[model samples]
Target chain A: MTVSVPHSLDDAVRLLGEHPDAMLLAGGTDAMVEINDGHRRPNAMVIALNRVPDLRSWRHDPVSGTVTIGAGVTYTELMQEPLAELLPALAEASRTVGSPQIRNAGTLGGNLGTCSPAGDGLPVLSALDAEIRIVSSSGERTISVHDLMVGVKQTSLLPGELIAEIDLKVRAGWQGYAKVGVRNAMVIAVASACLAVDSEQRRVSIALGSVGPTVLRCADAEQQLSNAVDWTSGAVSPDAIREFGTLVSAASTPITDHRSTAEYRSHAVGVLGARLARRAFATSEGAAG
Target chain B: MSNQFFTLRVNGADHEIADSWLGESLLDVLRDRAGLMGSKGACTQGECGSCSVMVDDSLVCSCLVMAATAVDQEIVTIEGVAPIGAPSDVQQAFVDAGAVQCGFCTPGLIMAVHDLLDRTSEPTDTEIREELAGNVCRCTGYGRIIEAVQQVAVQRGGAK
Candidate 1:
């Protein structure tokens, strides 16, 4: 077995191009667990990405109102000051991921790499309509978060391609994330939801996790709630919120699992959606997040 | 694939590890190869903080870190927390507060407490609980552990 620690994004991609079968290691939070549990083994080469500087930094485009986060940026960094202020919903999701130790080592790119439906970062990425930047020796290309995740633990990324950065647009109005788990800390989400309101576009976006194979967007629910909100007053009726929750629940195709029942997951997402809708469309200035 | 040879710098000393598996965890190498048994492996997963260590100022579960991938990084284990022969203030506080029960999870808790106090000198009870949530202790019901952290805060002059 061999391990190659590349110091730059170019070198990392080049190495990937040379060894398409090499397993990529970001923070090793998920991969190492699999290795420890005897579920996975490194056959030939392991590409460690933590040393790559380009994959560990983030940048903001003022004109585009977008934040591009490097693939190796840890969740702890995401929950900190500047990035947290820029992406509050992402920050909130980051806080709920694993523990502090896990957060210190886990990366958004790892979340995308695993592409689990229960991943805390997925709902936020989906709700924000984030784009994934992929790189290879040949060149770079972009894909939406929705398109990138094909199914459970599955992705459309071709071999020799590395996730370079995640691009999220900063939108107008409020955005927040919440998840229902068995316990408060270090618990995987049984059902999770993210809500983002773009007042400028007069649109509301909702995404659910752990209730389906992939993070699902509640398009009908979003449209119904968006149209129900009075942009001038920034108020939404309780009836609209209830209907929105029902619509969101109806969108989920959950299965009964040991962690939770499908009925519970579907119901929990509805409650989460309604709560988020209330918070987003609250009439009081300070009440809305 | 064969055993990978690498140098891991731990507690200011570089240890050359040879004939190690590529899938060996940092915790595995620290205990087996380097003979540093201070970091215990309870869950063998990140769910338990028994294998907590500081990798370049970041507290992470050593079991989740690939040993070969940590070659160039500075790794700090429980054995490196104090000076030559004396326990650190945090360790001593754990003893004075009687926070040791079975002593398996003590090392990880000590590392976590050090991290929390270093970041927030005068952390509140809620903050301390939240910060130490990762380090679980089935014994003592965590009352004495919380008391020890409060004691350390006062001893360190962070709290009145």
Candidate 2:
């Protein structure tokens, strides 16, 4: 077997472009499990991206209001960085991933590559309207998180392409994440929600995970809440908020699984969505005050 | 497999190994070749913290780490933390609190606690819980384990 370790992003790009069949290994927290489980029998080649220094660093562009995180950056790094405050939901989700060890080794890019509907990072990325940077042998391109995830265990990633980084547009807003799992730690979610509110723009975004084929946004609920609330005062009518929860419930398409019943998933999403929205609204008010 | 070789500095020692199987996990190499038995191979999955070790000062599951990737990095295992003669403060605290029951999860727990105390000398109960949440224990019910951590925190006046 050929295990290729590229020390630079340029080298990685060239290697990936040259070897389309080689499996990309980042963090290896997930890839190793797959290999051990016999779920994936990699051919003679494996591309190890952890050694690429450029893929492990992050930078913020104040002028563009964007925070670009390297694909190889681990969750533990994110929790201890300044980005924790700006992306509270994502940070919170990262903390609940597996365990301290897993968080320290797992990369955001690996989570996206898995494309699992129950992935904790997906909901928050969707809520934040995050953009993913992709690089192939030729060049780089960017796509919305919502567009990248096509379905359960599926993504828009093509062969010979690698995720370079994830770019998040910093917005003046408050956000929170909550999930219902079988256990307190090291468990997958039955249902989860991420709520982001941009009061200045009179916009709200709700992303629901584990209750559908992919992380889904509650567009109708967002629109209803945005139209009903007074953005300047950060006041959202209670009755309209209740209706927003109802719309979010209607949007879920959960299935009965070993972890939870379909009914429970739907109910949890509705309750958690409403609770998160209220918390985000409160945080915004506190910041404004 | 290629004929390339790399040197790894683990636990204050340098060792050269073939890079052909660089994709192999560090856990396997440490247990099979290095003969460092402190880090256990429990689930072989990242879910269990049994194989927890420090890579360049960051705690990570050894099972998920590639041996080649760990080249030029500093690694700290349970054996490294507690040499043959002396033990770290956290290890002593574990013994004092009666936290070592079955002992299967002791090394991982000690590493987690070590990292926590190093980062936050005075961590609150909530912070301790958050830090230890990642390390699971089936024995002692975690009550005694937590008590042991609190005892250390109190002895050092670390908890505010």
Candidate 3:
């Protein structure tokens, strides 16, 4: 019945080492609901890490072509000026999050902690080839977003390890996020896609969410389109966009769930992929991102 | 387990409540402990904005917030925004536009509109709808509620 608040990363790691079974509470947007519904319980202890200073900030290294977002950076914070400019697709996805209230409290780390396939930020992370930064009293480790999400609401996070931040490259390209949902707001994505067209590398990356067990990367699509599109000129033909869409849709291994059907999810993601690709082709601002 | 004495500052006033569960929601603490009942407890989850409040200038559903987490944070409930006998322009606008029916969702809506107006002086219809998407009303069909927002905007001379 103890709720432990740690103020520093060392203190947090120490708390985790001491109480390996304790539940880590960042924003508690999803954790609290599970506790209230009697679906889950924090055994013996709850480590409240929201107050930890080191986990509450972010930094961008222009020379390294990467941005490291603190685990505590909420959706509300992500949608603001500087961070939004650096990661516009993530910012765009953040806007579609539950509500202002939810955005205010929900954190990027919390979304990773939950590891839900429907999580808005996951596809963006996948598209960007993001890496999750994990820490413990023992040491620190980094894993790709592709490997981090093992399954639905699951991860490979070991005992006593806490996610510290998300690290991703700042691609010199066009980036956009689009989702199909039941409503204009506050609805879980039936299907969502994040498209990042890297002009400098002459490549395209597409990630789809809620259509499979995990946030899925369209390797076939990215591979095929990298050859088809003229990435140097930042131009993509409509035919290329359609071909990319078809490949992304084929990548999804969806199931019929309460939110949507497998066929519809497939179709919706294809459409979103095509639309975002076309949008990225026309936009000039994402090269600096 | 030890119970800590939690002190919360709400609407320019401080209140102390002892021996409360750490997992108790901020919505419950405001209504049950501090006796500020303006934010209703309709949905204990994050979906319904009936328990909306401002915590450190950020809008969040109090139901989703832990009371232990909200300590020392500045909180403004609907009661604080418009005290018992006195109503803010947003509150009066709801009355003027007949936005209240069952009246349970009004306080939260008022708080939401209040928060929105604070940020954007003259928000468009689409903007209003998008911002208040979290606050759901079963009555009034939302037509008058939208009207009420416009009423407040007009009454304020397109300024906050």
Highest TM-score: which candidate?
1
Which wins on DockQ, candidate 1 or candidate 3?
1
Candidate scoring better on DockQ of 2 and 3:
3
TM-score of each: 0.97, 0.93, 0.93
lDDT of each: 0.92, 0.83, 0.87
Badly placed stretches (over 4 Å) of model 1 are A283-289, B1-3, B158-160
* Candidate 2 clash pair list: B122-B158
Worst 10 residues of 1 chain A by lDDT: A280-289
Q: What digit string (tens of lDDT, one per residue) describes model 1 on residues B82-111? A: 985799989999999999999999999999
lDDT tens digits, residue span A65-123, model 3? 79999999999889998999999999999999998889889999999999999999889
Task: Write down the DockQ of candidate 3.
Answer: 0.57
For model 1, which pairs clash?
A1-B1, A1-B2
Docking class of 2: medium
Reference-based TM-score, model 1 = 0.97
lDDT-best of 1 and 3? 1
